[model samples]
Each structure stands twice: as structure tokens, then as C-alpha cells.
Target: MIIGICGSPRKQATEYVLEQALATLREKGYETTLWSVHGKWVDYCTHCDYCLTNKECVVQDDLQELYALLTGAQGIIFASPVYNGGVSAQTKAVMDRMRAVVAADKNFFKGKVGMGIVTGGDRNGGQEFALMQIHTFFIINGMIPVGGGFFGANLGATFWSKDTLDGVKLDEEGFRSLKKTTKRFAEYIERYGVKDGGKQS
Candidate 1:
């Protein structure tokens, strides 16, 4: 299944964009699920190393369920809203908490495909930097990172929401970029398949 993770604390523009991307995946006949972190309690890693021997997070939060979803997903889309020129604290917390799974298995994300989507208040509101941070996480975790292409989404799908849902709806180029990225992600999954539960399926 394809998993779209919305890292936005608010359920507005960021959620809308992620839903649109998931809709495109569904249109292409891919099984998809949307995981929203709006109210999820994903705590940051304390580097306690408890997971190193236990193979699970000691914090015992919502991330336990998220880890299962992540492990089972063939493709993943991480979407976040720009906050002070970077990803929101909620998004960063999710990424940081992923260390529990990573500690369990060094290549936990191996062969999985990942894409990024970012929403900004302005046309050039640090979208690229946010994408880079997400892409870096995917790479360090051993997942393949996919970009939108050579055009509007050379990094990833970026939306200028102008800090509002209605403004996001008005960004035609942003919508197009998201659609194109979704298409590419689906195609890649179909052609190459994914590794689930540490095995390629």
C-alpha cells in the first residue's frame, strides 16, 4: 500500500495538498492510506538507546502504530507546512522518533520509495529547504527519494498556500506539480515493487 503522511499540525492547506496527491494515486489504481499527525502524539527521541536492545520505542506513544504503517508501505509521501523556514515541530518529531525502527534494523527503510511535499505561505518560502531536509531523512534511512522532475518540482511538490486553504487551491502550478509527482511515484512502485517487512514483495 502507498502511505501519505501529513505532518501538518493543522488540517488545512497541508492536509488538502496531501489528500490531492493521494487522490491521484487512487485514480491510478494504487491502494493508498493517509496518515495525519494533526493530533498524534509523536515524541522526539531521547537517545536513551532503549530501542537498541528492545527493538521498540520506550516512550510508548502513537508512533508504534505509525511504525507498522511505515514498515508495510510500498511508497511514502511526507507532506509538511513550512514553519519559520523549516518543517513544523510535529513533522520533525515524527522523523526523530523513527530512530526506534532504525535502531531495530539498520536497513528498515531499504528499497522503500519516498517523496516530499511542502506548503509555504509565499512563492519562495523555503520550500526547497524543507524538501531537502525530508529527502535527507529518506536517504539516511536507506529509502529511495523521488522528486517531481526537472521543472516546477525539481525538489518535490511545493504549494504556495499563502497561509490559507483557499490560497492553496488557487496555486495551479502547485497542483500540477503534485499530480506529476504522484504519477511518477505510482509508476515507480508498479515497475520496481517494494520491500516490506525486510523482504521485497
Candidate 2:
């Protein structure tokens, strides 16, 4: 299964593009799930070091479910709206709270295929930086990161939403990038299967 995580808080461009990305994967014979962080309760990591010993987070919330989905999936597509030249707080929270899941099993994310998508309000709204941030998390967790190779999609998928869903729909280049990224993602997973389940159970 491939899981697409949408870090947007609204039913806007970010979520729309992510849904399309998952649809593309589904059409390619991959079972895909869209996990949106919108309106979900996910606490920020407090650097308490609780999970380091207990092997779990001290606070319980929606993230508990995400942990399972992430580890069990063959691939992960982390999609976020660019915020201050980076991922949104919701997306970062998901990335940060993974410490507990990783603490429980250090290799849970090892060998998994991961990629990123970023939507921005402006043409040069640091979309690439936000995309890179997601890749950094994937690398730190031992997952293999994939991008859209060259040309238009050199940094995975990126959309200039212009702060509106309709605007994103009009982004021809963005759709092309999404197509390239998802095509590569599906092909990579099909050709070189993941090395681990990354599951806790």
C-alpha cells in the first residue's frame, strides 16, 4: 500500500493535489490511502525524551493511527502547503512525533520509499525548501527518497496554488510535475520492493 499524507488544515490546494497524487497511484494498481491532518489533534513534540525509554509517546492522539499506517505502507507521499518557506506546523508535527514510533523500532522506516509534494501561494514561495525538509526526514528515518529526476520536477512535485484551489487547478506545470513524480514513485516501488514492513506489529 502507498499512503499519501496531506498536511494541510483545509480542503484546499494542498489536499486537492495530494488526493490527485494518490489517485494516480491507485490507477497504477497500487492500493493508496489519503491521510489528512486537517482538523486532527496532533501535539507538538516536547523534547521530553519519554519515548526514548518507554518506546511510545506520552500523549495519545490522532498520531497513534498514523504511526501504524506509515510503517505498514510500502511508500509514503508527504504533501504539505508551504509555510514561511517550509512545511506547515501540522506536517512538521507528524514528522517530529515519529520519534516515538522510531524509538519503538529503529528500523521501522528503513528501506521504505518516500517522496514529497509542496504547494505554495506564490510562484517562488520556497516550495523546494519545503520539499527538501520532507526529504530530510525521510533520509533520517532510513527511507529511500525519490524525486521527479530532471527538468520541471527536479524537486518532487510542486504547485503554485496562488492561495486558491481554482488557481492550483489551473497550474499546468504543477499537474505535469505531479504526474512525473507519481509515475516515478509507482515505478520505483514496483521495480524495487521495500526491504522492510516498517510495521510495529
Which has the greatest lDDT? Answer: 2
Per-model CA lDDT versus the true structure: 0.86, 0.90
Please give, for residues 16-134, the per-residue lDDT of candidate 1 as tens digits: 99999888888887788889888888788888889899988999888788888878788888999998888888888899988888888787787788899999998998998999999
List pairs with backbone clashes in candidate 1: none
Best model per TM-score: 2
lDDT score, residue 144, model 2? 81
Give model 1's TM-score versus the native structure. Answer: 0.95
Please give the RMSD to the true structure for each candidate, in Å: 1.5, 1.6
Q: Measured by C-alpha RMSD in angstroms, how accurate is candidate 1? A: 1.5
- Runs with alpha carbons beyond 4 Å of true place in candidate 1: 195-201
